[model samples]
Target: MEFMLDLAVSVVSLLVVGFYTWSLRGHFYSPKMATGAKLISAVVIATTLFFLYLAWYEHQVAWVQIVGLVIEICAAALFWWAVSASRKARLRFAFDPDHPDSIVTTGPYRYLRHPFYTSYLMFWSGWAIASSSTWAVVPVIAFVIIYVSAALGEEKKFSKSPLAPEYEAYRRKTGFLIPRFDQR
Candidate 1:
């Protein structure tokens, strides 16, 4: 049972990496942006592979395995939804906040200011939970910090841009990384 669950987690991790890579096609980036983007992508890929490596030896409890799979799937769905919604927005990598010409407020963006980051958090948290190791949380923490930094950087760019007013309004209606039901 442990091995089977581990194998499943490994498969899911690979799919997540594949999906993310597929989503990046055709997006142009400047040299600086490309370097940052590559670093980000490398970190993500390494983290996902680390999860697979942990699965090879660490045995996860059945409940954690099941729950992790559920969270990963949900995160994947959210990612797809966000990507689909921003299909026409010409969304750039989060590393390049200044590259986006417009703010996306459709689909998942309508509710979450950073749905992509939220989904990433969910995915990483799910994997950490599945690993059933205390050390697994290190990567999760690192990713949380990274995502928050990226989101804040983007927010700073937005505040400095002409879209500040519109983004402020949108921010009021959306949550930073979670759904904000109590809109003012």
Candidate 2:
């Protein structure tokens, strides 16, 4: 019964991510992009799936699973919010030093420059916790490195856009992957 429950949770969680990602298909414009960024994005997907699979296969502590669920839900919510807000910017999912249609500074972007990446971070960390394996840390750390690289690379892309000045100011004032509590 416990196994069945874990399986169900895993299925639902994966479906949510899969379906949402699918829906984003043509929403983000794909300009001529960095090959390395594409590779990193692929790595993000691979690492995420591996960690999530581990989450279900490994024995999960009840409290940890609950905490994971909470974090995952929060992350999903933020993703949705960020996506909704990004529509105005013609948000693309990849890194293109030439593809800054607009610099989004409202909604989720107001608090964190990379709310989308934050969601990914939360989602993976939650999955790792849900896995309840100390070994899960490996993939979690990898995800962090990959996501940070992509985020920073994307920011560099933005710096080349028409909004470079504003983007620079935003970058200085906003947090990278987390909210800047220091903002006054």
Lowest lDDT 10-residue stretch of candidate 1: 26-35
lDDT at 48, model 2: 63
157: Cα error in model 2, Å: 2.3
| Candidate 2 colliding pairs | none
Model 1 clash pairs?
Answer: none
Q: What is the lDDT of residue 48 in candidate 1?
A: 76
lDDT of 1 at 138: 89
TM value for model 2: 0.84
Clashes of 1: 0
TM-score of 1: 0.91
TM-score of each: 0.91, 0.84
Which candidate leads the pack in TM-score? 1
lDDT measured at residue 147 in model 1 versus the true structure, 0 to 100: 88
